[model samples]
Target: MKQVRIHGPDDVRLDEIPEPEPGPDDAILAVAACGICGSDVGYAKLGGVQGPAPEPVPLGHELAGTVVAVGDRVRGIEIGSRVALNPGAAGFGLGSGGPEGGFTPRLLVRGAGLGKSLFPIPDDMPFEIAALAEPLGVGMNAVDQVDVQPGEKVAVLGAGPIGLSAIATLHDRGVEDIVAIDLSETRLEIARKLGAKDTINPKNDDLWNDLGRLHGTEQLYWMDLVDTDVFIEATGSGALLKKAIERGGNGSRISVVALHRQEVPVDFMTVLMKQMRLQGAIEYPERFENMLELLARRDLGPMITHRFRLDEFSTAFEVAKSPDAGAKIMIEIG
Candidate 1:
């Protein structure tokens, strides 16, 4: 079996290892496709999220595969069944006290704990689309937290994969008056294609001024008269969070979906004064099934922008890290 391993920062190597055998209550999956997530870039460039690298770990989580073999006790999911592998490992990547987390040619997954998260990929769903269920699940989870309403004004900060996923999720939920704000024109264009009603290049225009110009009098009630009802900050930059807070209206919900690599200052006094709801969102806890269902139903396909082969994993990572790279970057495994 061959797997991409991150030995250290900027030190990824493809290594061959023993093929995994499923234990009791486990299933071995043949990797079909895996999406390179933003977190994988952080891990590959900055060791790990909060600490140093734990092991020379295989780093992909957004994946879809087929069941090649199953353990004696595994049920419901049988061999030869096509499935989308949920690398979130039933919420926290713990995998019911299994071995370390990874993305190898063969994945040994616990059948019982997998639950609805490990969905049966529809025959109509392509491998590349199936690979995106995980990140779409993340965006779904964030939108679920904010509870976006139809016709409500929304602003999505940062047009990265997650941010664009947020835009897609919001659009799917029927929010038509959605605005995507980002510094990169490429990402903004991608966001617009994914149903963002308006795209703002933050570098060129003052966000509040633009909002006021677009929304007229309604924008004045919010910061500098920007009438945004729900604001999602996905940049993971503390500066963006603070700016979103300052620009949001009273009682508006601002969801923080990005993982900040370092701590930065925020305006606690302004939050209290404005009575804003600042919420922190993590990975999908219960939205994976719904996201998978949406994918299976073909409601979300515009977000997948690029695909590569397993041997081209480094190029995939580079594309993911590149500013010009659009939505999800997927690697074909099988």
Candidate 2:
């Protein structure tokens, strides 16, 4: 078997390892596809987990696979079942530090509790797309934070994978007019394909003026632009956060879904004066099923713009870091 591990800053290795055997209460999966996350890039770039990268450490989480073997006590899932690994559950990838993750060709899940960390998917779904259940779950969790009413204006900052997913989720919720903001025109184009009503590139256009046009108002100031009922901050940019706060309507809800790389200062008065319902979203181990349902219907296949084999991880990582890269980058293992 081959597995990818991070040794130091900008260092990732694909090493040969022995196949894992399942315990009495465990199961083994033949990993099919694993999506590289932004967090994975951060961990790989810094060669650290908390502060800096440690010795050789496992580095993967978003994945889907087929159950190849199961222990005696693993009752719910059987051999040959297609499944998605929920890394948020214990004994999976999130907390376990061993040099094993979805990056490998196979995964040995510990405990009969394996059922708690896995979700079965339809046979028709592509493993590469199924791997998206994890990140899409993140978008679903973010959309779940706010009550986006039908016909109400909604805005999503950042046209990254998560942000685009949030826009699609909002569209599914019947919000027709969605504003997708980003600096990258390529990303904004993808957002438009995902059902975003308007795409704004602040680098070239005035965001406030654009919002005023979207709002159909002749004249508007920064504080006066308040038509958006739900604001989703997916960029983790303090400037976008301030813009979301400044442009949100009274009693609007804001969901901060991005993982901030640094501490961003916020104006308390802006939040206080408008009574904004601001909240943060974490991983969705329990909601993979919900995201799976959405994936079954939505044409989110365009989200994956790049695919690479296990041996091409170096090129894959480079593509993922590129400014012009599309929504999601996937690694397929067979």
Candidate 3:
């Protein structure tokens, strides 16, 4: 078997290794495809899973594959069945108990029970789309946190994969007034294609001034003057959070779905004055099915912009890291 190992920052190697033998309650998967997540880049830059490189670690979690070998205890799922993997059971990286992820040709699926972690997708779903179920699930989870009403305006901060997924989810729910805010014109264009009624490039346009055009109001107010009832901050930009607090409509909900490592200073008074509800969103271990359900109905092929074979991981990583790179970047393992 061949696996991608991160020995240190910017050091990734494809190494030959022994394939895993599944236990009675486990299974061995022949990986089909895996998506490169931002956290994987973090691991490469930090030299390891949690901190500096202490030992080699496997990277990649958003994956889908076929069950080549199944333990005797594994039921409901059968050999050669296509399945989408939930890496959340393991902390999503090598440092945690998560099975060495789908970056390898073969991976082990083991736990007290495999039901929650292994979701069977429709046989017709392409492996790449199946692999996307994980991140799309994340978007579904974040959107689920907010009670977005129909006809209400919504603004998403960031045009990354997750942010676009959020827009797709919101669009699916019948929300037509969506504004996607991002610094990338390319991403904003993608957002427009996905469902955003308007795309704002913070680099060129004043967000506050633009809101007036979006809502047809000079004074953006929560008292029906401002129509943005929900704001989803999908970027890790701390400044966006402050802007949401300062400008978000009264009683609007803000779903903070970005991965932020630093403490952001927010104006508590603004939050109080607006009576806004702010919440954080993490993994979508439970929303995989819902995500697949949504994917089943919509055309999500556009979300995937870059694809690379397992051996081309270095180039894949470079593309995934580039801001100009469009959306989902997948590594074909099989």
Provide the overall lDDT of each model, using Cα atoms, as 2-decimal numbers. 0.74, 0.80, 0.80
**Candidate 2 — which residues are off by over 4 angstroms?**
95-99, 112-114, 216-222
lDDT of 1 by residue, 153-272 (tens): 888888887888888888877889888888888788888887899988868998777865664433333345356788888888888777777777766789889888788687887778
Clash counts per candidate, in order, are 4, 3, 0
Winner on TM-score between 1 and 3 is 3
Q: Write the per-residue lDDT of candidate 2 for residues 1-334, one digit (tens) a residue.
A: 8888887788888878899998888788899999988777777787756545446777778889999998887888888889987776755454235446778888877763556777898889999888888888888788887867788877888888888888888887788989999888889998998889998899999987787678543213246755677778888788778777777767778889998878777777878877778888877636568888888888888788899999998899898887477778899997
Model 1 ranges off by over 4 Å? 91-103, 111-117, 216-225, 285-287
Candidate 1 residue pairs in backbone clash: 219-225, 219-226, 219-227, 220-225
Model 3 scores worst on lDDT over the 10 consecutive residues at 90-99
- Looking at model 1, which ten-residue stretch has the lowest summed lDDT? 94-103
lDDT of 3: 0.80
- lDDT of candidate 3 over 48-140, digit per residue (tens): 766665567878888888989878887777888888887766343432324475689888877514566778888799989988887887777
Give per-model TM-scores. Answer: 0.91, 0.93, 0.92
lDDT of 2 at 287: 52
